[model samples]
Target: MTNLKIALIGNPNVGKTSLFNALTGMNQRVGNYPGITVERKVGNFSLNNQTQATIIDLPGVYSINPTSTDEEVALQVFFDQTNKDYPDVVVVVAEAENLKRNLLLFLQIRDLGFPTLLCINMADQMQKKGISIDIPALEKKLNTKIVLTSTRQQEGIDQLKSEILALVNAPTTSPFDIKTINPEYFSAIEKNFPTIPPFKVWMALTQNFFSTEIPLDKIEHFRQNHSIDVKKIQHKEVVKRYQFINEVLKKTYTLDTTKETDVRMKLDRIFTHKIFGYVQFIIILGVIFGAVFELAKFPMDFIEGSFEDLSNWVLDTFPKGKLTDLIANGVLMGLSGVLMFVPQISILFLLIAILEDSGYMSRMVFLMDKIMRPFGLNGKSVIPLVSGTACAIPAIMAARNIENPKERFITMLITPFTTCSARIPIYIIIISVIIPQTYIAGFIPLQALVMVGMYAVGFVVAMLAGKLLSKLLKYKQESYFIIEMPTYKVPIFKNVLLTVYEKVLSYITNAGKIILALSIILWFLGSHGGENYNNAEEIVTQSEAAQTMDKEELEFAIAKYESENSYIGKIGQAIQPIFAPLGYDWKTSIGILTSFAARETFVGTLSTLYNLGDDFEEQETQIIERMKNEKRPDGTPVFGLATGLSLLMFYAFAMQCTSTIAITKKELNSWKWTAYQMFGMTIFAYIMALLVYQLVK
Candidate 1:
């Protein structure tokens, strides 16, 4: 019974997450709040091994006034005591080096009358920046307990835990006067709802104009009767809060400007510059793609080789049967498809986490806001677009922060156009075959440049599509962009590595399950067949060409013939003509068709098809090498330059992932809009593939 739920809240980049990772370690799971797309992370840790506690890491927000739905969720918990997540105590995390800016949200939380403990994170950076805070004076002035902790150095953690455990009840009185923030509105609301807290009443009214929750019908009616100026009251409340925060800071906080000039400012000058910022961003992307290609190849090859050996061992150990084929060809092949690319995915996530934790990623938003505005997007859109490169599902979910429906919808529509992790495997498989592995300047790999070029193609197409959609879906809402530029520091290796591990694990576990199931189903379909398939041996042996072949070659021909007559091959052949103009044969057509459910299924499908009767192996051939050896009846490679490029173009444009479509439907709440996005991209993909194949051939 000795249990409590604590909510940790703060502005972004305040090392709040670092502290959470430190406190919870591996005891965390991510989920969503009920009836909302906003992500919620809950973790549990025992205090002193006596009292158990649940800590919810709420989404980061700048203030209580909710512009986006994520911020609304944050404020909703504080405003509505009836809500399930009303915390027992709040831990408001602030940046010690940037206490003044961090204090705004803290003050807002304190006003809500929750038992709040102020955690000044990044205390290790305070002395380096020559910033000093009178912790005792600040606690006394703000009427709260303060803990100066450093997640980096593991400082003040015990002190923070002891303080958090000891705290029991929230203070009865508000930190600042609620009536002082606009007497007319407060007095009016308080007069009617005398029993309810005035601060809660005010919040319910202000957010009611935006939120769908109907906590107080009286407050909604009362606000309508009074004809409240929502924006005007919001502005007045911010001004009043800052006035109080400034007075408190003047007494307890000081910064010496004489220290070494902030290197962050120097970096910002170029990093946020209009022209230079974009140039640097492109350079950084090229480096990331280059690292993904050249650096990950070693581990990727090892993984592929190891799996191939395992598959061969499974066949060698077990008598050939239906179960053995399913285990070796279906299950192991699916697992390999999932895991072989972990090195590349982990590398990309690691580099991205470093940029994000180091605070350089914010500059990207600033630089992009300029170009994004004309396309009906702002700095916030930069997040979903960039995250889309990793996966479109979460990226679309992240787009909830856009506030503008038109812009958010457009961002959602084009987000899938970005080359997701699924596409990375497909790209690697094809590019390694067609693009020569020559080094550029003997440093950068030529294949890496091609990878980056593919990403560039996706981004450019997404942006152009964004511009086109913006024009078609014009709206009158004005958008305001305000993002804080956190002080840059060396990225914490622990945090970065943890992020990479979690994300890469998620990719394998979540995507792997689907791949495994599909792989088995594909194997079954490829292995079993009707009269023609059953008669494949009879059909092949009767041919004069079969008599001249060697034993291994004859067996290979029989297996291929049987597979072509099997259920899956017949299905693929049915759609062959549709993709024939795009240079894809029946086998390639099967991969493309199966991939419509999930792009990662592309590799699994091919692996299952090519893995038939693959027991007699001496040197383990890679999936790419197998693909390279594939030929047409006329004695030409199937995956030649024109065909590979065409396939690449098709996948790059195609809206193949059904997970994205489901999320799009959920977010947009309209089948009409989702259909426009789904079928529209598919049509475009087909046309582009057709053009490229025809022109090149």
Candidate 2:
């Protein structure tokens, strides 16, 4: 079968990915570019039995002259001929409402002389907002095929596909004439690179093409070495395109400004209020987190119990062996660990989509900017923080919108500190295990209040970190936060469903792989080792010292010996000395190490290490019993209130998510920052945990 490479490119929030899903269905993978952290989404679909097409969904951008890393990736993928994998055809998805702004990008692609197909998406919104376009005129003027599509309505999708297939077979036609900088300048370039595309020459002259791609030796040796002010030239080009768009719209479209205040604007006025807007935003977010933990409790309980029941059933049915133990104790534990968090994560993202669709998020940035001034964070940085709850990777990506370099960098650094939904399961289990259920103000459970307090600590620490970095970095840029509040329409069900599907799938897929791998590795580490390991050394020694102990006491002592000397026990032993001052035993040490893959794995790791031999719920009960009665070498209880609080504090501040570190490296453009972040966060966590443990103990 012949393979065709096609790219879907457009401005952000243009539903490009949705269209890609509509085309590719479930066969998709979420990956990052080999070197950079930019998301790489590629999928395959059959155009015909004879031809299979591979589709790449490129990052959204405003123009080829890239500013952000994502935009740069898009440009490199499109313009860098050395890549040998450039798309055969570019599908430009443009939002119908923002045609003028969207057209600028489309025109840039067209000028590149590539096989370009224009998709005027969100066509349904156009009619509702009183927008009409002369389709034939647009096609004729742009000299490219146009497909009017409404992804939400599922309109014009088949038409779009047909147009795409036809584009492959249709003979190439040079679209519009390239706009000239000056007649003399163009003529001179035309003479110099006679065989080359005129726009290609212009791109080189303007440095839109990378420095190496331009013939520096040839340029210096010829053409009188005339220097061009390319920045000025590019600005003129933008003006020209806008001028053309203004003219085209005069004939092809009309808008009714008399449409009164849109629901988007009305909602924004309240949600983005200078004072009330921010309070409401905070309260709304508080509700989201609160709801995820409180309201989802029943379902999470059911999932936890179900998994426990399944594990016990397996233990009863299967003959005892290493493989049986691994399956019941490791794989099931890992799967349960990941699956338990799905409900909370899904609800968190659902709230996020609602806020975004209601157009309240953009205004929250504006409202919060004034308040964040005291905390050293740009108000714009809040978006990344808000989104960080879903995943730190995209949250870090969103930080690019902060124009101030120092602010952006600091935001990227601290975003991981925010408790993402991936940590929800870990937090829930640990808090339940540690915190007492007493109420403070007659209603708020002490546990819930502590959860809120942890969030506050994270926010305060992030603010302080941002402020410190802002002062440390000497470079200055005027901080400005301005965003177009998109018109609010009723939240489209399909769009929300698609978003939740993509984000949740990305999380589960990544977490499942890592959790499963780490679980198996941990199981092996905890299962295999030394002759005297998991032996009766402690019990034998105690019995030898005194024959006065009763059999029940001896039996208890033997169980402790077996647990402390188990394969996992020995591994944790070597590291136990490090965290001893923090009131943690060897098992806690193993939990910490295993949790680096994902924080929530801590509870499951402990369950496995203890040989609880039950599912998640049963393990929780066993854990409570074990922790309550566990002893140190001195026979002191392992987890009193002090130790429990210490563990809780440690998780609250620690950088435990490997995916977050991976994203940090990608966003900061170096391992240096990622290293600094991990080290600094770990050290900070250690110090804080030490202080709390020391004071309480």
Candidate 3:
């Protein structure tokens, strides 16, 4: 069978992802483009059971002229024919209603001399919007096959696949002449680089970074000899292409303005209102937070209880030994700490997916832009900030969407302040233990309100940090905020499910590895120790306190004594003084140290440490119960309100995740800035936590 490669390219919010999902279904895998953090999504399908086709969903771009890394990646795939992702055919997905605006990108791709097909998406909305296209005429004029697809209705998918197959064997052609923009200048360049396509040469000259067979010094020499005005040439090209697009669209497309309704405009008015927009957003956030805590309760309980039982079963069924102890007390206990919070994480991602699918997220961006601009950010920064709620690794990667270096840098540095799902496990456990389970106004759960407040604190701190960074890192390059408002539609369930599944799975897989390793190590440290640990039984038995204790109480006393002198305990004791100001004991100090690896590991570390001495047959061990009963040497409760709040504030601001730190380095491309971000945020978190504990205590 012949193998064919296809690339899907389009402007943002043009139903491109929806069409990709429809075409590929569950046959897709997401990865990063080599040597870059830009996400690459590839899927496989058989065409007519004869040709095997691999389709790449390229990052969205407005035009061949790139402004951001995302657009640059899209251009590079085409610019370098030797690129692994270079396609045999390109499918330019366009919106049915917004064909005029979408055609600019289509024409640019068409002129690249690829065997391109125009996939007009969202055809189901044509009649509702009173829009109609002459597909045959448009295809003839553009010199390509056109397929009208409605992903929601599953329309034209078979036809699209067939067209893609046919196009693979079709001859490539450039719809517009490059010489049309500047006959004299382009003609000279075409002569100089006769082997290269004139359009590719032009792109290579205009782009800041381009991959090509041509030597860089030669291109620089050519630029120096010709003294070319790149911006002028780019402007002329856009004007020429739009001139051609306007003529083609005017004759082949028609819209009945009278038949269209003002529902969208009215909704936009309400959603974008200055006063009510924020009000609605707050209400939506409340509902999401409420659902996260309330709906996840039953499943969280089930997971926690299930893990408890599994641990007990492992202890009871397996022969008593080190391996059995490791499985029961280390791995299972550690995993349960993070896994029990999956339901809440899943719900958060699900709601975020829905908001994005319905296009309400765009309005939030627009609403927040005014507030953001005064700080170092614009509306585009809102995406990375909002995405940070899921995970900072991808959230930092999402900053690539911002064209300006300054804003993008600030966004990356500050995004970790937003409470990610990793922090959720820590926050939920802490909040539940400290806050009362009561509601305000007889309906709103106070716990949920506190959760929302934690989110608010993170966001507010992020904004302030952005402002300070903007002042510190001076850049004069002005950036405009431009975003397309997609037509609102009922979110596709498949897309939402896929998004939630991918995000939650990513969280588990990434956090699982770190937690597993740390859990076993922690268990070892807590299980065995130096001479002190071995002598713990004798030490406790001979104590005056042991004289009045019964057998059960005496065993408990020995276990406690052993834990205080264990290997992990010695390490924690050495560092306890550093965290003592914040009311942290040796165990809490150990959790804080492990948290630097990943915030979620703090809970798992604590779980593994506390469960090491569990008598599973006599009683079930839960991390929360163990923590609640913990006391300091002086008999004061360890997890008092002051300490709980302090921990929350620390995680809220700290740069804890190693993955996030690595991605930040990659995105910023400077260890200087990365160090500044890491140490600065951690120091700030420490001070804030210290202040909170002192004031509240």
Give the whole-model CA lDDT for all candidates, comma-separated.
Answer: 0.78, 0.71, 0.81
Please provide, for model 3 over 112-171, each residue's C-alpha lDDT reduced to its tens digit, 9 standing for 90 to 100: 668999999999999989898888999888888999999999999999999998897676
Clash number for candidate 2? 3
Task: Mark the regions of model 3 whose C-alpha exceeds 4 Å error after superposition.
Answer: 208-211, 380-458, 472-478, 580-652, 655-679, 689-697
Query: Which TM-score value belongs to model 3?
Result: 0.84
State the lDDT of candidate 2 residue by residue for 1-697, as single tens digits.
Answer: 8888888888766767668877887777667665655666788888777878888888767777766544565577766667644778889998877888888888887766578899988787876676778889888877789998876678998887778777776544544455455666667776886765666667665544633445766566443565667777789788877788788778877777665346655676677667787678778877876776676677777887788788878889999888888888778866776676667657666776777665566667667788677656767888778766655655665675565455777899988777676666666666776776788779879888877777777767777877787777665445544455565656666656666666668667754565566567766776665666535655465566437666655554554455566676676688889998999877788788767767767776666556554256566667777766778889877877778778877876788876566556656667788888888888888898899999998
- TM-score list, all predictions: 0.82, 0.79, 0.84
Q: Order the numbered candidates by TM-score, best leading.
A: 3, 1, 2
The candidate with the higher TM-score, 1 or 3, is 3
Residue pairs with backbone overlap in model 3: none
Q: Give candidate 2's whole-model lDDT.
A: 0.71
Candidate 1, residues 40-116, lDDT tens digits: the string is: 66788888777888888888888777666556666677755676677889999999776877888887777666788
List the candidate 1 regions with Cα displacement exceeding 4 Å: 35-37, 79-84, 209-215, 259-261, 273-276, 376-457, 471-480, 580-652, 655-679, 691-697
lDDT at position 34, candidate 1: 68
Q: Worst ten-residue run, lDDT, model 1? A: 612-621
Residue 273 lDDT in model 1? 82
Per-residue lDDT for 583 in model 3? 90
